[model samples]
Target: MSDWKLFTDAACTEEFGGTLTTVHKTNFSDNPQDFVLYFANVAGDPGDNQVLELVEATQPGTNYLTMSIVDANVGSGHEADEITLATTAAGLDTAIAGASLDLGQDDDSIGVIRLLSGVSAAQEIHVRVENAVPNEGTSTELSSAMVEAISRTKSTA
Candidate 1:
């Protein structure tokens, strides 16, 4: 029989799960149109693995918000796809501008962006959000805009 086991003892075991960390909040501005919301793998014990969750409370504009992950450290070479938001739905919409997605209003519209690989400590995952199409609006305000990092853990049996 194998020595490996799954946790059954409630007092002696810790759950194989993820921890949520708040990364960023919206601070409205007019210029630049594009901004870096959060830089992952920079601070804290962001756990061993992670996925990004973006929440926008209000509709920023009629256009979509594009999210991309770029190389932060040379030779570390983490691979992840860019996510673009243009409408109010949950899932991938790749046909639009290098796989763009929509950022819908309210709590119901939570965008979950999964990383291609688990980010190593000190290796950065650069996240940016930009207006796909500019409008007459001077400032963008969200009722509740924030980014969260959800850590991933492994389970054995």
Candidate 2:
């Protein structure tokens, strides 16, 4: 699969329940060239009010990266949810300048983004749940599991 794997954060508190996970190559192999980041809601009780964040370990200047997420779930709750991986509002807007993203629908959804070369290979990439209001438990588990699975796939591939 892929060399990347999930490394759980032990510093997360109840305010940030569950672990914030990062996916990276096992050995941080020769500057990851081409790869598409994918995330899906695999197993969890469906609900609304769920949000996920994609974060990258970054330095002041050297590295920059941008990507957008598109939900792939089917049916009503499967409405396309797109989010750009940016730390600033301006950056996010720039990243999704021409993309059409819908935030409507229940919390049960999956999204994926294509990683570009601007992102630093030395940085760790991951997703963070912003508000786990309605489905905190299930969201935490499912999201973590989804990331874990994807990282495993990359590692094994």
Candidate 3:
């Protein structure tokens, strides 16, 4: 049976803008798998126009999973939007702009993305939480960010 395995856990209270990448140790087989992210913003208020996105920070390029709002107080509301797993820079930018997650509130949200079939066994993978659109001087605090891996196992025919 396939099960979810804890890959990484991170928490921070500092205010940051732009992109933040956290590298974690993981053993991902070449088989199909999924990367699940559980994250929350406990304290502080992320501005109205702030957007949060969880991305796979690979060496050659980055893959975007979903986007959310950092502040619930924004007009957009708290909702996780799907982003196309495109490798191009313009495609990624457009995808991120279309989604938002409200992080100013106390509640948490999950974002899941499928790992590429060609993914090889690696010692570490980078997970990035980006605040693309921060409203002026406002900032948000990341209470916790957890990543879990779920792999599919094959059975002998």
Error of 1 at 152 (Å): 6.3
Q: Which residues of candidate 1, in runs, are more than 4 Å off?
A: 1-42, 46-83, 86-118, 121-137, 142-153
Q: Model 2: runs farther than 4 Å from truth?
A: 6-70, 87-90, 97-121, 124-157
Q: Give residue 32's error in model 3 in angstroms.
A: 35
Badly placed stretches (over 4 Å) of model 3 are 1-70, 75-87, 93-96, 100-113, 116-138, 141-151, 154-157
Give lDDT tens digits, candidate 2, residues 30-123. Answer: 3212222322221111221122212222421112223234443423221222123333333443444223322111212232321211112212
* lDDT, residue 89, model 2: 38
Please identify which of the two predictions, 1 or 3, would achieve the higher TM-score against the true structure.
3
Question: Candidate 1 lDDT, tens digit per residue, 1-157?
Answer: 0111112122213321211122222342432122112122212224434332222213222223333333244233212222222322222232232342332222223333222122331112122233322333322221112223233322111
Provide backbone clash counts, one per model.
7, 13, 6
CA shift at 148, candidate 1, in angstroms?
8.4
Candidate 3 TM-score, true structure as reference: 0.24
Q: TM-score for every candidate vs. truth? A: 0.21, 0.24, 0.24
